[model samples]
Target chain A: MDEPEFIAALRSLPLHPGARNLEDDCALITIGNETLVINHEMMAEGTHFRPDADMADVAWKLVASNISDLAAKGAEPVGVLLGHSLGRDDARFLQGLKEALLAFNVPLLGGDTVTATGASTFAMTAIGRATHHPVPARRGAKLGDAVYVTGTIGRAMLGFEGAAHHRAAFDRPEPRLAEGLALAPLVSAIMDVSDGLLLDCWRMAKLNNQTFAIDPDAVPVADNARRDECMRWGDDYELLFTAAPGAAIPVAASRIGKVVAAGFAPLVLGKNAFPTADNLGYSHG
Target chain B: MDEPEFIAALRSLPLHPGARNLEDDCALITIGNETLVINHEMMAEGTHFRPDADMADVAWKLVASNISDLAAKGAEPVGVLLGHSLGRDDARFLQGLKEALLAFNVPLLGGDTVTATGASTFAMTAIGRATHHPVPARRGAKLGDAVYVTGTIGRAMLGFEGAAHHRAAFDRPEPRLAEGLALAPLVSAIMDVSDGLLLDCWRMAKLNNQTFAIDPDAVPVADNARRDECMRWGDDYELLFTAAPGAAIPVAASRIGKVVAAGFAPLVLGKNAFPTADNLGYSHG
Candidate 1:
């Protein structure tokens, strides 16, 4: 579709009286004084999952991955849109899809389906309501705020390394919805750890113009093969959050470090941070 | 991401004030009297596009494909979210992505990027707003409504046959955004002809509980290819709409046939409806 054609068609629709940011991904549609915020995430075949992976797990993982993004912003789940590649259109696949959707309780609204030339892919867009307070953004962290995480990290990455239990952990890192919702009203800034702990922390710090200082020892470890490897290896979908030193938050959190206004780069134990030697998180170009 | 963990996080976000059904693929976010509808469609590599396809055209078609879906609904484009696979994050690739976004004039709302295990894929979620009147739906055709199409058909399929121009046409379709936007308020039912004339029309008929009869000769052809093959080949992506006779629609359309009380199967008026043929389109299991 031509961009103009799309815009023109959208403009032709009657403006919803309270819809704000109509042409943006996150819209603040107001009802009275409250705003509902929305965003979506998609996973593809051979890209997000292995073609030979378990179908039921694939469906479950797609939903989980997208919902994790919502959790980062403390947004409540409303529903989802699913686009399925025609490659995986068998009855067994459908059964798994149904199981995943039902398990999430996020009803399927509507979506398009097409045949794929090779490996199958699936996309899921998640919608949710924003809380009254500022929706937690990647830019909300402040100097002097302490950094914390909801659960142990590196398990998901470990799972990817052929450790069956760890692979399952990596495959299905639970969204910290409880922690996110609880912390939404308290945290300075928030984001989910999808890439690697060090990488995500670096990104969050850059977004907020702050530096993260991890004690290395304080960083929570999921299980043990190696703490540094876990931190650097990607796929740990946990919540990396920041709050005031004495915020008295009520989520299961382990203080990994603190946010500070010092050197530009993330630091570990008062030293410049690097994925090697300590953190083992993955990097994206 | 585990389904429960992901869903738990999503469920934690605050609810939108006007969302009637926020947890579905398509949701109604009411802003006062007006309600904005949102949906997302994701396409993948080896599924939607070849990994080594022209990056620029691939990106353009990705956006266009999702936008085409919105066009079919008579909904206007609002924004888009992209889930990109990090197979090869080269400068040229990023440039291609930027061009596609700029071409669509849709802002890059936040999206997730992850490295794929195999071929590259991209998932795009298009959020569109429905106009005051109900946007056309596949299930709205009546027993007597006439079926019509916008623009020439079958060029895309022909493109796949190594016809350079036809191939380009196949890869990049002129999404009938203008016609769809213009007809949304007027048409009873609307959809893009992504699959083919025979199959898509069949789908439309099935959705509306009516039988669609098409005079094969009356159907527009894009080239002098085999008549039967043209009817079954997929990837045309044109608007196949249905409306009452003489509805005074704004878009120029070619009349093909009419809707009738349910028929035993989708009917074709050529040599034989069945033709012992491949039907010219791709199929999903």
Candidate 2:
């Protein structure tokens, strides 16, 4: 509906516990002592994925990508709502979707579907449960805590270059749910490495009012091709987190760097944080 | 990215409550005490919307559509999550999205974003609360319950006929959030009117194991179309429900017909129920 109608509709809702009001009802998950709400993100063709990508991978990746967000927050994925275009509803596509849901353990609750007047578009809203473990908010890193990554980075980037055995990396990046769950109770703050390591690090730093200094040698690279390009390309789906210096990490986390009280914005040794602007993860309109 | 890797990535998720385990997650959100746990829906380009549609309206309609589902359950809208694709990150689009979030009074909690390989898509997961209400479900209509709908139907079908005013109806259909909330504690079973009247009614009947009969004359139609054509077209987004005989409806609900104990299939008042090989609702494959 138009803006007025939308406003009218929202105003019409009766307040529920924790909703406060319509404007605050973004995410509806119960996290820690509060509820986590969410909204919509639109994905467009030719940008979020390669047009020739396998239909099944497209469907699985779509669900996996969203579930990773909940994992980043250490929130347990509850259900998903989808806003899908018409072309992707064929039997093959649905088969892929079923596989993805089964694989991730996230259920398809309910949602709306419509036809398009142009290119296809897809969007989804995923809900999760927030528990006693810290919610791993973006703004909770401490000054002296060390920054760590749950798994290796750059594999997905290498796959983009057609490197041998790298195709799988690019096509399907793992969602660090276990690592997130294990780290949730320990990490000061956390986020997923969907964007390039350098860029995402900068984001965490800015959010925490801290800076990250990474030792290039210590950064885990899947292979040689990925060693360089992965620094620029994004979509690794690893967990980047910060923890206290003396803390014991539950997962097999690699020490990427140390969080400093103040420094040049999230640097990789002496270089600009991300080096590339246009290729900083994926952008949607 | 491919099927195997995609499956591996998805299989990596840890078990959670709503997920019910990573393998069988797509079940409809049905919680303890018969409480419908959540509402899910999807919006996609070229299927649910027009490319040239106003970004603000698109955002608003997206939220409205999902909320309407919760309203149908007579459940309180709790929060939402979004899945977005990256193609073009236009400032205007973000602005419109923010405006819709603010207008809807639902907070923009959290979501996932991925670059797409094809058209754009937007999906929403809206979790609602209905602890005390019997939580109107789709399969609750019984014999002799009156079939009814809140507001008009077939407007969206007619709205799709042209690129001007009619498109508005199609582009931005109002989600009767208030009407749904008002009726939540009242209806025997509830459902939103996304598919055409005949198709959705049939679905409701099937889900409830009852026969739903909608009088053709009682069906609502928009101004732009012929009677018969409109009858077949869906996208109305109204609330269709069944109530016990002599039960009073709070909103402007039209009395269509009654649920029958026998006659398992959904039927028109005078004609035989058409069992088409093809489903009548919009398919997103």
Best by TM-score: 1
Per-residue lDDT for A77-104 in model 1, tens only?
7766666655453444555556556655
Question: Model 1 chain A: which ten-residue window has the lowest total lDDT?
Answer: A16-25
- Provide DockQ values for all models, in the order shown: 0.17, 0.28
**For each model in turn, which proportion of the native inter-chain contacts is also found?**
0.23, 0.39
lDDT of each residue in B1-285, candidate 1, tens digit only: 332233333343333433222322344555555555665555555655666667666766777777787777666666666666554443444555566555555555444445555556567777666764654567688878888987777788778777887876766665677787788887888788776778788777766767787878887887655766787777787888888987886878888888878756655555345322245366532
Per-residue C-alpha lDDT of model 2 across residues B34-111, encoded as one tens digit per residue: 444455556666655666766666666777777777667666655555555444333344555666555556554444
Please give the range of 10 consecutive residues that has the lowest summed lDDT in model 2 chain A. Answer: A18-27
Chain B TM-scores per candidate, in order, are 0.82, 0.80
What lDDT does the true structure give each of the candidates? 0.66, 0.63
